[model samples]
Target: MLFSLVKKDLLLAKKYLMFMTIFSFVSPLLIASRSSFSDTGFVSLLITVLLTEYILYISISSLEDKSKGAALLCTTPYKRNGVIKAKYLLILIIFMCCFILYTILTYLGISPNIQQMSITKIGTIMLVLSIFFGILIPVQVKFGYEKTKYIGFIIVFLTPFVLPNLIKWYTSSNLSINFTISLSQNIYGWIPFVLSLIIGYISMQVSIRIYSKKDL
Candidate 1:
């Protein structure tokens, strides 16, 4: 039953997935051809682009079902938990595919040195992105595409501006307070990505409960 749900989702999202894959490949080429392209810069750009692609994919995929009013799946022999699990499983599959593609690009000299970022930092980044993607998925499901798009835009646009200032203010006022302890010491040298993953999972579960009760 879960497999069927996942299959349905993939079928519905086939076009967007293809576009994303092509974009992932072409984006690196465009970045590499730019005047400022260094190994580090290329890799950073690739990661950023790929992250945005994955988040958008997950959000759109979740919205597809809601937009179509696919209530039949909810009435099947499968439980709502199974449906949610399938979505997460799909997310894992997407993550693995993106990771493999990124690795290949690194090996081909299209990106930076993979070893530059330690495993812990890399893991943390992946975890944080995964959690964020997870959170966005449920919101997309709950709110549908239009409202979720506004919320998503606000988050994507405002976070970059807000977080730096927040960090600067915190560090400026309390150097002796040891902000590093509160932050993740791993890959990006910041807060543990595991924290985001934990929160995201809890939020996803909450979304599942709410979606199960929804009319459609």
Candidate 2:
């Protein structure tokens, strides 16, 4: 039943996936060619892949709202918990696919220094998705995407800017919060993955309860 819901989402967002695949290959070439990049463009690779999928998932909510899909789903025979689980799982699965796509391209001898997509890199990606899902889903479920649209835009605009600065600050600052995410694979690789799992789990539970109570 959960699989069916995921399939429905995939079907509805087929065009987004189609567009993502094209960028998956093309963006790497462009980023690798740019002069201002360090980490040999791997930063760009991760950001581009993540932002593309993040926007697509958020767009799905907007689409669902426009079509009254969530309101209708609430009236269906399906369990509300299943709807929440499948939605969260869908984001995880798409993130894995994008990671794998880049990994394979680099494995085939493509450069930009993506020789291997590290556990920490993938973990950080999941953390980003988890944060967005944790905030976006409950508000969206409770208020509908129409009410959440501006919040989503602000988030979308702010995230890319904020994440990099946070990374820079953590990497360079003398504060007690001394941690470099890019190098965490050695010291704290598992932290982001574990934290994201915890966060995503809690988010799912919250969404389930919110969705179940809503009169939609």
Candidate 3:
């Protein structure tokens, strides 16, 4: 049943997947060519992956809301928990597909200076997705996409542009505490992956409960 739901979503969002594939490949090329952000291949790769994932994520939600699909599904044999599981599963599948495509492109020298996509890089992307969807999915389950779209936009679209400056300011400010922890440290390096798994699990549980009890 969960597999059917995921397949349905994939079919519904096929156009979105195609659009994102093009966007993913083109954006990195543009970013790599730009003098401003072209400082590193990693930066361009990060932007491509994050933007693609966020777009696909919202596309599914928008489709569901517009079609009244979730409410309709509730009237069928599809359990609400299964529906929620399918959403998380679909997003995870999308994330993996994007990662693999980008990884292949990186190897093909699509992004300048990036020879390979590292494990740490993968972990970082997973962490960001886990947290991004963690908060948004439950809110979306509770309130529907209309009320949550703006928040998603701010987090996924606006935050990236402003985050660097915010980080710079926070680092430069004379705060009471200031220190740096290198991701090179073995313990620190694995933290992102660990947190991502934990957060993903908790987020799934929360979304399942919210959806199960929802008056759909």
Candidate 4:
């Protein structure tokens, strides 16, 4: 049953999966077409990776809701927890595959230096996704996909402005940052990663609860 649920989402999301796989390969070349092997190419590649991964996950889940698939799933014998669990698992599988593809292209001299997509970079990307899905899934699960656009607007417009400044502040502070320093030591430099995981889990719980009580 669990496998079936996962398969269902994957089947629903195959188009997103296919598009991202192709984009992950061609994007780096497109970026490098203008800048050769410079930092701009690397930056563009990363941004493109980040954007496509975000879209891949967002569209998979959002489209299901928009298509009334979520409502249909509710009427099935499948449990709400399974629906939430399968969705998160599907995103993670796709994300890691895309990230690995990005890493491979970088190493194969196709893409610019990705520096192995270091754990910190990977975490940052995952964190952004965590926050996105964390907020999006609940809204769609409860209010339907139509309401998700408002949150989508917030992520699109606000996060770009907010995250860079937040990362800058976190990286630049000194003794005034003793508390954050403590967190860094205690969490083994995974504070954002940990927090995002927590948020995603809580959001999944919220969605399950909402979907359970929702009018199918």
Is 2 or 4 the stronger prediction by TM-score?
A: 2
How many clashes show up in model 3?
Answer: 0
The C-alpha TM-scores of every prediction are 0.66, 0.83, 0.83, 0.73
Of the pair 3 and 4, which is ahead by TM-score?
A: 3
Off by over 4 Å in 2: 35-37, 40-42, 158-188
Which candidate tops lDDT? 3
Q: Where does model 4 exceed 4 Å of error?
A: 28-46, 61-67, 150-154, 157-187
Where does candidate 4 have its weakest 10-residue lDDT segment? 35-44
Model 3: weakest 10-residue lDDT segment is 35-44
The 0-to-1 C-alpha lDDT of every candidate, in the order given, reads 0.59, 0.75, 0.76, 0.67
* Candidate 2: tens digits of C-alpha lDDT, residues 100-130: 7777778787664555656776677678778
Off by over 4 Å in 3: 35-39, 164-188
lDDT of 3: 0.76
Please give the lDDT score at residue 18 for candidate 1: 72
Cα deviation in Å at residue 126, candidate 2? 1.2
- Tens-digit lDDT track of model 1 for 40-83: 33344335444555554555456665666356666677777777
In model 1, what lDDT does residue 87 have? 72
Question: Which digits, one per residue and each the tens of the lDDT, describe model 4 over residues 129-153?
Answer: 7887787778767776666656665
